[model samples]
Target: MMISVLVSPAPPEGIAPTFGWGTFAAWDSDLYRNIVINGYSYDFSRNEYLVAFFPLLPLLIKAVMFLGLPFEIAGFLINNLAFLGAVLLVYNWVKELYSIKAARWATAVLVWCPYSLFGTVIYTEGLFLLFSTAALRAFQKKQHFWAAIWGALATATRLPGLAIMFTFLIVSWREKRSLIAYIASLCSGGGLFLYSLYCGMKFGEPLAFLKAQKAWQPAQDFWGQDWLKMFMQVLVGSRNWKAGKIVDPLHIIIVLLICLGAYLLWRSHLKLGQNKTQFGYCILAIILWLLAGSPLINTVTILGGVYLIWHFRAQLNLLATYGFCSFGIIFSSGRATSAERYTYAIISVSIALGLLLEQYPRWGYPVLILFGFLLASLAVRFSQQLWAG
Candidate 1:
């Protein structure tokens, strides 16, 4: 956090002031703080972007301020504290899956991830991690009801969270083969359902959040014909470096690499005695990529998800259901612009990478060092209001 502040120069023109808040609160942090202080407005003439941000963290910030702490302090503390809790839950959860050594590696990788800086800031990553990890832990313990409750909170934290419900359904079916599991799984989306109701009351449109998303940027659906046309153009080289919004050479490469990684990782897992389901997960991921237009963010996150499914192949149904569904929810919308941040919600990426490193200690040290270097570099850029993600 201190390095982030020191490396960042003074705020540029038109940028929101930190107002004595820490530099960590820059970028999307300001949007959250604004919502905390001013509350939501339906007036598009004002802050229409607020509708896109979920209410959990900002509301927590406001609640904490009642204890005489300022929003900055409250926001920062909440994020860090929630992250600490998440770390603990993740440690125990991974340990339950394998050994304590693997658990430690998983926790370390999560903490040292290039994107972990956002978890330490006033962003929703920390809180989302807290809820999502709790949900996973509860589900692993076979506490289906509690899992649904925690999963519902996770959904409230982020839209991708609804994907977790699929995992719950799988678990329930495998454990009891009952319809109650399906019914209970629906509870996972209760938060989004409630939010839609709130939007209906406040904006006269239950899907106002979807509409407000346009105010931020132009986003396309992954299933749209345009994405397929653009993908083909990028592949055929008919589209140059800067052709259509959809066909950036860099992002196209990212998509290709993601596909290659998933395939290679699937084969490696099978060679290691992992099940066919691992390969099935990879195939499912590819199908989603084909349909979703495979944005850079989605591509990277899906690659991570494929690796995770392979790593947790023993629990293939459990992790695969959650991983694929989460990717599906994000790609279902078609724009992968914020995927760097959105990918954080996947959580399995960090764990899977950590597990991979643990199995290959010779490669682990260098990878971690590289991760730290990129993390610090990105932190500096993000603090300076430069786009890193």
Candidate 2:
């Protein structure tokens, strides 16, 4: 946070740069601040709608504002504190289920990943992660009441929290848990239900939040070609994909070389040691993702999450189920914007990556270094009011 504030460059001519803590409160932060100070508003003509944002973060900020703190301070404190709590919870939870080493690596990944910038900024990522992680941990411990309570708060914080509720309900049914487990699962969605009720009473539209999303990214067809475009952007460069024709022969050559390298690596795997082979694969994947830009990063975050969860499904159990449910919601949204941030919020991805890194400790160092560079870059971009995700 300090780095973001201190290192932000001056805005371009004729543009005012946000300074100090305010720098963290750009884009979506303004909407949250407005909601906190003046409550929700919907202005169709101006495309201004607070209904599009979930209420929990603003409400929490408002609660803190009663102490006479400004919205920026309140929001900054709330999000940072919640993120701290989340990291601690992740550490302890992973340590308990896995090992001290695994816990450390996972915590490092969660804290240093580029998307961690959202946790620092005025966003629901921190609060949502804290609540959802608490709910998942509680459910794993068979503490149904705590699970439902935390899960409810989670749902209120973000839509992905529905995945937590679904995970509990489905897992309870599959495991034939007691009625209390089932009841808790149903009760987990209380936050969303309450929000819906408020929307119905205020706007005469219970699904106003979902509808308001069109204000940001107009709804696309359910099985649209957007996903294909995103995939193509990953294989080719975004510019070439957007050109609607092969604008760069270099992109094609790079893609073919990557494929060839992968095939060669697989064929020669028996000759290489396990650690070397795994490290080589990791390096290759990172290179490919970096070359592809944000679209590929977003695509890989979601699809790679699926691959991770599925590969470790037996071990992850309910966590895997939650990951799938979250991904399903992202997929169903039919838009790719912010997919990377959303995927980062799913605790399963961190846990899975942590577990994998624990085995190949050698890979964790370079990965963490890379993550640190990306994290700092994102923080700088966000502070400059540029799109970091």
Candidate 3:
């Protein structure tokens, strides 16, 4: 439905070739008339730095562009296919663990979510989420090899994906089957190693993403003399940092309602005491993911794990709350350019994890949602203040 909607609205014009990088290789290339064959890093026009983005997403976009489909159409088609995969996995997941209503609501929320359109930006979110969830669903059934294969694909799509095999760690430990999970995780985790090695050989460091972030100045100035002062300000009373302001009070209200819905989902989960461990893994994964990487990388691993909180009987804990705050701090303290938008992930993931802590109870769900929205409410206000120019 999404693809067709955008397809008629936008169709491809002609053919193109993009064999290499440094020529606006990422999503920007999706908008180009042709994908030029250029080198990966060097010889880039000053304005072509958009190629700094990862490779897989653009290549997918290029293939779609090759189908004579417009860029927007291609993006929609890929995201639509991803949506289908996400839906199938989520539906099967909920059906297996909960009720038919849960399945319906879960799929409905994701499919109808406007914010999720961000995933359709010739990016990896849709594909990553779909594959990761499907892998988890496979694991739930004890299909080890299939789970490993999916994890490998998932890792290929999302950089943090290599960590997802940790699920197998728990499974293996509990079931006394280490060798298989080890083999699977190793095979899937190898790319992360290879990528690092290749990057080290090329750039004299194993952490290419980190190098890229530093090279591109995506974070604070590594050499700024005011680092101490800036860090203090960001942690306490921030002045230089930026956030957003929602112009629509009604949208604010709607976001509040969504928060309420998410709260209800959490409350529903906490009712099962024995299921707390499972809940722990899902929410703990989110917290850890948030703490371990950059904003984009954190979002994928967090979302992949959070997609499986179907039991609706989670146990709320204070430690989880603290972890969320710490994660938010790091995100908000980043560089000022579009830095505020990071709050969306911080708030959403935290709330999603918090919901896993307990069933916020039906009576309190709406009020808690209001509070969550209110807390996140400042995010919009901050964004406007930052981008006021």
Q: TM-score: which candidate is best?
A: 2
The local lDDT score (0 to 100) that residue 320 gets in candidate 2 is 92
Q: How far out, in Å, is residue 88 in model 1?
A: 1.0
The lDDT leader among the candidates is 2
Models 1 onward score TM values of 0.77, 0.93, 0.52
Worst 10 residues of 2 by lDDT: 10-19
TM-score of 3: 0.52
Model 3 regions lying over 4 Å from their true place: 1-39, 42-52, 112-114, 197-206, 221-389
lDDT of 1: 0.71
Which window of 10 residues has the lowest lDDT sum in candidate 3? 380-389
Better of 2 and 3 by lDDT: 2
Ranking by lDDT: 2, 1, 3
The best-first sequence of candidates by TM-score reads 2, 1, 3
lDDT (Cα, tens digit) per residue for candidate 2, span 1-389? 45645655575731245557787788899889889878887667878668988889988998999999998899999999999999999999999998999899999989998899999989999999999999999999999999999999999998778888889989999999999999999899989999999999998889888878867686555664677878888887787878888889787788788888888889989999777777778777877866776776677677888898898899889899999999898888677778889999999999998988898788888889878987887777777777787
Q: What lDDT does candidate 2 reach at residue 143?
A: 95
Using lDDT as the yardstick, the better of models 1 and 2 is 2
